[model samples]
Target: MISISDDVKVVENFVRVAQIIANLESILTQAKNLSLTAKNARVVALRAGDAALGFKPITNFIDEFSEQTIASTTKIADLSNQLFKVAHKLVRCSQYFHQMTLLKTHINSKQADAMYQEALKSQRRAASQLSLALSELENHFEDIQKQMQSAEYIAVTSRVEATNAGDFSDSLQSVSDFIASAAKTIKTAVVYNLSEIHTLRGVLK
Candidate 1:
């Protein structure tokens, strides 16, 4: 039987997983917003004609950044889902193993012994799987951080280009501000999710 304390630990781990998922969702939302802002900036650049020529290329970079961020978040989301499933399996395996251990003390049958061994093996396998999932999640988190850095660079460049857009400087500056804000939002979410993943790792341990 799973003890009350064990049940509570499992619930806490689940909550951590939920928080990670929520943070990923926030990233996706902000990425979409960045994409829209990029499109609007492109329109403004076109209106400014030759005066905003440099800003036009910067808008393209913003669009690319948005696309890459969305793609990265999608991969992270899928990995996190996999991590969640593996964590659930680990919990079940632990519970079953615990039960078999309790049974071993009361029963002396060879079949019970065999079943107990099998449960132990399952628990080990689940633990290994969880480890692999956590490693993959860490990789994805690192990838996102790298992407955010590149996005930050693009945002900085956008601001520089915006100032050179002559009459369109105000409009372009607004778009640059949006890009910077979205980049910050996405980076914050990634950091938050990374911390949550670490908490989940601790809970599993």
Candidate 2:
């Protein structure tokens, strides 16, 4: 009976840890949103030409912030993995107690029923927490997809704008501008998609 009680406590702790993981995931989502917004701002500023003299500072700030956000997300992901490992151990412990309850069912039928009920409740709670975490993770991926599409559009627009601005005396200058614009677009899109893919993989794991 004491062991059964301990198992239940372990399960409860696991659930609490899972909830904390979910909250951290939500924070990650917010960080992604901030990163996307910063990138978009930089794109707009770049398009505004010299009139946007403040663009450089804003862009630099965004670059630093985005990097920090990514680092924080990585840390959170590592912590979440650790939490999941704990949950897995707790589940195994619960199963052992469950088997023990079954072995002496005739003598302690009522006690066994109570213990089983508690175990089932823990499982249900854990499952619900996992489901919520998955949903949030999926939403984060969706946001990334949207950001990628937006970046692609911005890149294409930048190319068109540069083309319309007229030919340069130096062919190399025209080529340089085109290449820079294209690279910016590609870089933003890649970052968004790669991060999203990584997050999805984490959720699946």
Q: Kindly list the per-residue Cα lDDT of model 2 for residues 15-47, writing each as its tens digit.
A: 555654555555455445546655654565565
Candidate 1 per-residue C-alpha lDDT over 1-205 given as tens digits, one digit per residue, 9 for 90 to 100: 6799889988988888888989999999998998899899999999999988888887888788788878888998898898889899999998899899988879989988999999999999999998998888888778878877887888788889888889889999988787778878888888888788788777886
True-structure RMSD, every candidate: 1.5, 9.7
Angstrom error of the Cα, residue 33, model 1: value is 0.9
TM-score to true structure, per model: 0.93, 0.43
- lDDT of each candidate versus the true structure: 0.86, 0.49
Top-scoring candidate (lDDT): 1
When summed lDDT is taken over every stretch of 10 residues in candidate 1, the lowest stretch is 196-205
For every model in order, what is the number of clashing pairs?
0, 0
Candidate 1: regions farther than 4 A off: none
lDDT of 2 at 146: 50
Candidate 1 is scored at a TM of: 0.93
